[model samples]
Target: MKRSVIPREFFCRYTPEVASDLVGCRLVRVIRGRRISGIVVETEAYRGPKDPASHAYRGKTSRNGVMFGPPGHAYVYFTMGMHFCLNVTTEPTGTPGAVLLRAIEPEEGIAVMVKNRGPIAVDRLASGPGNLTKALGIGKELDGEDLVMSDRIFLEHGRMAREIGTSPRVGVSAGRSTRWRFFERGNRFVSRGRPSSPQNP
Candidate 1:
């Protein structure tokens, strides 16, 4: 079951579109010849500079400049001054849009993931953005890495989710009105299992 890497064109769409479509895709990280991967189960979209919850909403800066570049790049950022969160840049070049990879269902390198996130239930290993990044060894050094071509990390095409759920994004002080969070219906790995109305991208 060798999956093909998802192409850059897949991420060139609107951030919400990319976020919704990203469910069930594979998020992979390669370290020292070992591959750790998971099925993307949750995502939150941050629309361009207008979306106040987005880091780019305030316009590009030294930290968020990568998000304004071409789509299909990694947008890793340190949050809460302690943990890292991973996002994928989206939209046309110069547009500041991205999809936060909120959660994933572990598929490979379970041993490594367990090592990073010790003594946790398997499904809980990557149940949140910070947890997922820690399990997959993603950090600030991976910021701006091109996902379309990076050998260390990249997305792979996986089975599309037959059912998807949508709801307002979690943990955002602003842009709470935007129902841009998406997750695989009934996926236990999702950070928040509660489902609202389904959205069609």
Candidate 2:
């Protein structure tokens, strides 16, 4: 199949829209000349300043400066001193917004994903943000990389989810009422996590 990279314009909108629309898109990463990819299954939007759960909520730092840069770029960050999470920058230039890629359904390069992630169930290989990055061999090196024009990593058009579900973002205390988490309903590859508080109707 001919794969078309998602344009930068696609991410130059509201952060929540980009997060929701990213579901079912393909995230491709090239490692050692091999392509490892999967269909995006879950995401969470973070609007800077307004979103208390966002890294850019306070202001831009050396680590989060990329989020204040142009859209369609990768914003990778280390968390808990162990895991690296992958997020795609959203909104227009100078706007601090991003969509955290929560999970993905493994598509191509299963063996490589298995190797990268160790012996795990196919569905679990990329079922969480950290795991998804590990499975695709993504790390701090790809931070701030241009997803729209980069050959090493990029997004592609894929099968859209038939049913998308929404909920409050997991592990966040402040944005409990905001339903910014989006996932493909009934997708086995989607991560399993509940919000810190009840979601508002």
lDDT digits (tens) for residues 115-193 of candidate 1: 9999889989999899999999998899999998899999998777979888888888899788899988888888853
lDDT (Cα, tens digit) per residue for candidate 2, span 1-201: 655999999999999999999999999998788888999999999988888999999999999999999999999999989899999999989999999998999888999999988998998999888888888888899999999999999999999698888988887889788989998888888888753433232
Candidate 1: list runs displaced more than 4 Å.
1-3, 193-201
lDDT of 2 at 120: 83
What TM-score should be assigned to candidate 1? 0.93
Off by over 4 Å in 2: 1-3, 194-201
**In TM-score terms, which candidate is top?**
2
The lDDT values for all models are 0.89, 0.90
TM-score to true structure, per model: 0.93, 0.94
Best by lDDT: 2
Worst 10 residues of 1 by lDDT: 192-201
